[model samples]
Target: MPDLRLSRRRVLALSAVATLLPRSGLGQTSKVARIGLVQSTTGGSAALYGTEQKQAIELAFNEITKARTLGDIALQAFHADDGADRGQTVNIFQRLIRQDKVVAILGPTLSNSAFAADPLAQQAGIPVIASSNTAPNLTKIGDFIFRTSVPEDQVFPTVLAYGVRKHGVKRVALIYGIDDALTRSAHDVQKKAVDALGLESVGIETYQRGDVDFSAQLTKIKAQKPDAIILGALAEEGAAILRQARQLNLDPKTVFIGCNANISAKLFELAGPAADGILVGASWFAGYDTPRSKAFVEAYRKRYGTTPDIYAAQGYDAAYLIAEAIRRAGTATDSRAIRDKLAGITDFEGVLGRFGWSPERDATVTPKVLIGDGQAKVFAAAPAV
Candidate 1:
């Protein structure tokens, strides 16, 4: 409950010159601006995430348009399904830039898809606000690339620290999908945290993205008898790993931890009783008591008949972020103006709390650590030392 509001210094200043510049030659002739939404709505790994992201983007865009926030300019959305294929993602991105003439794009859900697709958008001079790509090196792709979701570096260590201090976790086991760039990056981050905290890494294991059998990895993890197990896989895989580990006599006392991937209500339903003690790090949860957050949650539930997950929350923020940039630029058609506006974004608050872009083009935001019982509820902030 400490003062989490952004300070005045963090607010971006719009200079008189940038504000007064003439838009006559900046492709401002159009009365409507188009934003392309790229998501993998048909593929196995990303279908659920993509559906949620699309819904959230549409909700935010509708809200903005209904408020007439952009005056006479109409905001239109163009959606393309990536199908969870990197090649398809690249192709669709090119189409969005060349054919639809979208000023900005909201997603390509998977981090690997972003790695493949965002470069094309960057080279084409179109800004992309990645809704759910959390791997390292994403923002480092280029100045045009930005992500709304908190990265593993921002999420992991606190959860690890909590495990060590609150749950008495010392020795740890790590498991992740080696085939996935995002999961691999998460595993690397967890390893670094273990080294930094002087915690023993008892066992490290890897699995393929679609593989169901994890007996080999679980058996290895069981032999380690580590104090905690950290998983960098998505919800389905992570839940299965937890269940298999428990069945293999892995200690129930051993804490189970995951990153943003496990921040879904589906995990509890999927993993059943095995998911009782899991801890997940996240950016937004429906349990936030703020008026804005409560309203968003209520609206989302009314529309979708379910609680919004992190992917949905990030997608909503990304849409508003793009809309804010376009509004400041005075025209959505000017790529340079929009890019500049995006970089100067500061103190924009949303369902996720204070949102701003760091100089590196990464989102500068803190994460909340939530422990999943039947739901992922906020773990009370650790008392100050």
Candidate 2:
């Protein structure tokens, strides 16, 4: 709820000329690195995730830039609120390129916006990394576009396979938002995983983005008596589905599993007891015990006064990856050099896991977790095999 805009002083301080010059007596010239963040904040429903996304980006940028003497490569963040409008995202991306002269771009959060903004950034030759957008087309946009989030094709199979192999799930009812590209992609992947595992997709239903009533969908799903319900949507819609399912007295004696996006504190708060036993695939959970994750969670809490979400961890990892690229490139101005360095990066320890980018594999395989009852457990890992 705080003012999301950058302050005038911060803006002036981050400008190209001011950042490139050495401090009055430090005798150390700094490289001013401008990064533009284009995201949605417009629709009533879209605003739900905007504040959290912005806060995560700010927290990561703050942690990465603190006490650093990257001379002249002083990082600066500029934000543009696209309000989930496709046209607005395109316009903002162009303005940042022409006016702000940002070297890189990060996020429009949703894949719909990314689908619109990424092509523009690619055409302009700016390296763009997404924090949460996971449309499969995003990876194909250009070599210049990268994403910290796992692709749905990769993530859903892991979740589904785990459910079928480990949890003995035989039948699942999938409920998703057809309008959102990311959710649709997740559902498609879920179907493929179900078929491959020989588990029945008993009932499949779709909803719009802002529909508060899911009685109709839940009613049909309840009749099928599925072994579990798989949610392929954001937290808000997932919460609504669970709440409706409970109200319909259709509580099956089956476990509920959802994609990574459903593993959030807000989902629990929104659905109350209905969210109690829902299991979700997650990239990073606050309860993780890894030293790197512990340090990040502690630092983030101290700075933001709250536990960070998976998106925050992704944002942190993205910034660290960019910083490492800069360090390897040895020059902040050479974008191509940075890109090449990023591609060649290997054995780079990260909060999520070790990342090694090869020309053959554009995606980074990170560890995943499961969350329930406000606690996170390491369920399984994608082994190097």
Candidate 3:
């Protein structure tokens, strides 16, 4: 069993529990564990991701509560909007722990905010199930922090190698959001993959997170005339880059490859024709035919009337994963016990295959290569073959 004791300072930070009511003929009242869901509902470029994540969390929680799988504890979830802002992320982290006394927190969407806000939860000795922060260093924040996303280091290389072999890609150009932590980290991983695979480096260009115009960067990339363009950014910027690449008359035959962020169906809608044939790496897609995947998709569609992408799938898995932690601990009242239980979980399969924690406390599952053709289609990469 993992350690369940918090530091002396952390134990001191915990608020005194109110006295329980004396047992009557009606029996002792059941305690409800409040789980705080912090997400980017209103602002930021990843708001769509946040919406899907929130819906999935709610859906999973409802299913678990209906099944009564968590024993005597009834569960309630409260949501807070971080708006994808770092300051707002910190504010909500404090509020969720102090006021709500939440057993755990779900997400704040982006890696940038996670880098800033996760430390607060770690200090409070609260376990956080990161729904979609894929940056490699996230779990290093503390023992209490965990994520459902496989790091870019584990995901990108295999996917990129497949794209290279399948599409006959030799020379590759790179574009990433310099300001965003996830994109910047992804760019580094892409570089390593390109080098390890012996692919030519044509050019590397970058933009700030909110920049719209990419003609200058695209033109520079166009000059290199690479066989593939690698995008290490979120959907909004990735879509914009594709649209701009098309407008600039960059070679139609040149393939566009993106990180996990490009797996969303909305990217297809945003970029329209430009999104077609774009390749991405993801741990979950709506098209997976497994029984668990099918059931999750059906429940999500019935509840929200929309097909969930990887973000939503991960968020749903995060809810159940935390609930399982509480169940395994035999008590939802103690945050330290829940953290220990989560750390002990291994080889649990959800919609994602073989879900478990790596030695660093991040997700250990590998992603499957997916191609966008109006929707994501499963593709086997050559390296995996």
Highest lDDT: which candidate? Answer: 3
lDDT of 3 by residue, 1-385 (tens): 6322222213322311111111231133276677878778667568878888888887887787667777677666767667777887887788778977888989979898999989999999999988788887888999999999777788889788888778899999999999888899999999999999999998999999789999999999999999999999888888899999999999999999999777776787788878877887878778777898899999988988978888898998998899999889888679999999999999788988777898788877777887777433222232343
C-alpha lDDT of residue 8 in model 3? 23
Ranking of all predicted structures according to TM-score, beginning with the best and ending with the worst = 3, 1, 2
Q: In model 1, how many backbone clashes occur?
A: 0
lDDT, residue 255, candidate 2: 66
Per-model CA lDDT versus the true structure = 0.79, 0.70, 0.81
Give the per-residue lDDT digits (tens) of candidate 1, residues 108-177. 9889899988998889889999878889879888899988888888889988898888888889999999
Alpha carbon lDDT at 164, candidate 1 = 84
Task: Report model 3's TM-score to 2 decimal places.
Answer: 0.89
Q: Could you tell me the TM-score of candidate 1?
A: 0.89
Give per-residue lDDT, candidate 3, residue 203. Answer: 94
List candidate 1 stretches off by more than 4 Å: 1-30, 375-385
Minimum summed lDDT over a 10-residue window in model 3 is located at 16-25
